[model samples]
Target chain A: MSSGKHYAKGSPKPVLPDDGQLRLFSMRFCPYAHRAHLVLKAKKVPHHTVYINLSEKPEWLVDVSPLLKVPALQLSAEKGQPSLIESLIIAEYLDEKYPQNPLLPKDPLKKAQEKILLERFSGVSSAFYKIFLQSSGLDDFSLALDIFEQELAKRGTPFFGGDKPGYVDYMIWPWLERLPLVEFALKDYKFDAKRFAKIAKLIELLKADDVVKSFYVTPEQHIEFWKSRRAGNANYDLLA
Target chain B: MSSGKHYAKGSPKPVLPDDGQLRLFSMRFCPYAHRAHLVLKAKKVPHHTVYINLSEKPEWLVDVSPLLKVPALQLSAEKGQPSLIESLIIAEYLDEKYPQNPLLPKDPLKKAQEKILLERFSGVSSAFYKIFLQSSGLDDFSLALDIFEQELAKRGTPFFGGDKPGYVDYMIWPWLERLPLVEFALKDYKFDAKRFAKIAKLIELLKADDVVKSFYVTPEQHIEFWKSRRAGNANYDLLA
Candidate 1:
């Protein structure tokens, strides 16, 4: 029973390992896992990344993560007692356990707002993905992108939480990375990149950051992978 | 900001209403609002419930809630101040502000587990609702329901948090109430009510409780509202 305030003010510094022992079981393609990667990079937290093959999931990985989801964290040498699934929760846990560079704001209201943004992003992204997968037409997809643009515009900053990237930014930025591919897919529908100028600018800013740039992949590779999947290439490794 | 623990040990008295006057702007039929209702009922907290017409949302309601979603909770009398939106966050806020009955377990691992259940339930319910709306074939619907049944069986208890209902229960139970209608919609799917005996027992137990029973509406009314929506009768209030 960890009995203390939710936000421990003036607590002793958290002891982190000198050796790189934090193993992150993640797939590069999963938006959820990408959230954890972005946060780790932003915080400068040293961790070994273990890319899992979703199809023939390793027995050891399956034993640790019952759900077999990507972005499972294993701290130290503990195998069975690994801190398991959920990207947001894992990011939050890391932020709490190692609190030097805070991902969440101190104000309760601000924290609540961060949560709302995360929820809204999750909802909007799900809808966007559904429309993208089900309908080849870009009408609904454009509307979704427009909504994202509007949301970013309202923030009036490069990131969701104004100034420095926080929890919301970590969760949202990975999904935004796939936008180039989405635009490529719907090129015939007059999908203008300028329509999401604010978002594109923000993405550029994120990619420019030394820490944020650590997770960047070429947009072409992402599109090629999806195209392969669409062509019945079941053997393709989604984790790449 | 009112700051003090909401509940004390032993007596189990409800926290007095906030000095700013807490008012809940919600629709009766919304599962999200029912989350707030459950927390209030469990804690014996009092608040005014304003039922808003979904078809013609009032300007005041829209002003308070930009998303215009039901289950928004106003902590203070001031109209323009940001109110808590989203069911899980509202429930957590209530639990944090007024610590009666301890809706969440204090341990971090257990708390994580609770969140996983909430996330799983959210995913399953959203998928089920979509399938239900599309009136997909029984085989497809059954596959979805099978997943739900499997998840529930894993719980090994009626309530989400082993024997006792907690945050996850408040988060999920409202959606579960529509199961009868869901069953009716997929009547030809060999829907086995017996497979969900645990859920059935839990529902009966919840209904037996005065607090839970207060939120119940007849299945006929629920079905009528759902059917009306399908028939393009947009004027009918689904939340009522």
Candidate 2:
């Protein structure tokens, strides 16, 4: 089975080769999985991506992750070995385990600030869901966007990681990539690029990044996926 | 204004002393705040606690925390400085900054595993809330408890951190401390100590720790606070 195809319940589990390589159980369109994907690419970690059908999960997933969630990283091919779950934890593990491209700052305070920044962005995320998915809370979404704009402005840097797309940038990119779909879906809504210049520039820079490009889904494709999801028949294997 | 007292909306903001010391903004009864409190105590981090009335937050809270949440760690006494929020993030910051008693493992894989374990425990916490707070999800809570018991038994450790309480232990302690309140509130419920012998022992070990003792709220007090909260008038200053 090809890695890009999401393995569903009926599909036979792919045998793990004896060769030592990290395996990431993921769902193609899951933003959480995207977080791990970006980190793996950013850090250039040696890993294999295995897309799983979250709607109809594979039976063998229980062995891979105790949580039975996507974005679980199996450290090795060996059976009975525990796979790490939760996207941020996997990203942090990869960052610490492979120290080539350091995503987090060395200073503990600075590192915490970035983590806090990501935490604060939860506001933006919830508001985004309300506006785009539920078709409500437009004002709240706008407010969240304004706060994000101000945060970007306050940092006074090209990127939140200070001149480089680091932890916060990669973590946030998945959501930013989906913003265009909002405008596409709703006729009344559009993000004011002029107003949120810092974020606007960031979107462009991240879109151009080599790492993001590899896993990047086009806005149209994202819209198509969401449309399918809304219609109650999600196409998890859109790429396939 | 002593650090022990809960400062409310009308209260004037306390001046930051020229002395450079860490300050923690907290709500005495909040479990999340308790996590940071435990970490601070366990690590013996030099800090002063400033209890906040979450119902009616202090006007100056915006200056301390952008999110206006408890467990925000002000790294220094200097004004206009950013305070870190989110309990785990604050705990991690303290562990990194004050490394006398390291809460997290030095090995990246081991550290990630601990974090993953904590993430899994969210099920137990949520189930606890559903059962005790909302009077539902008893079966779910039982299942979560069974999973926890199995996890503890598998590790074969006196504490989640093995011999001593570490990150997962301290992080989960707040909720475990509150479990007795569940049995108290729900007459039909009682944890099977024999069935969950491992967790029962682990809880005993944690409760006896010096650090846990310092911030320990008696089960009676927790019940009182919850009763007050349920009655729509929470007593934030139970100690005061």
Query: lDDT of all predictions, in order shown?
Result: 0.66, 0.85
Cα RMSD for candidates in order: 10.3, 2.1
Task: Specify the highest-TM-score model's number.
Answer: 2
Question: Candidate 2, after superposition: displacement of residue A96 in Å?
Answer: 0.7
Deviation of model 1 at B151, angstroms: 7.1
True contacts kept of each: 0.21, 1.00
Per-prediction TM-score, chain A only? 0.80, 0.95
Q: Tell me the TM-score of candidate 2's A chain.
A: 0.95
Quality of candidate 2's docking, in CAPRI categories?
Answer: high
Instruction: DockQ for every model, please.
Output: 0.30, 0.92
- For model 2 chain B, the run of ten residues with the poorest summed lDDT: B73-82
Taking the tens digit of each residue's C-alpha lDDT, what string does model 2 give over A181-202? 6786578878888988989999
- Candidate 1: where is the Cα deviation over 4 Å? A1-22, A44-46, A55-61, A74-83, A122-142, A146-153, A188-197, A230-240, B1-19, B75-79, B123-158, B182-194, B218-240
**Cα deviation of B196, candidate 2, in Å:** 2.2
- How far in Å is the alpha carbon of B82 misplaced in model 2? 2.5
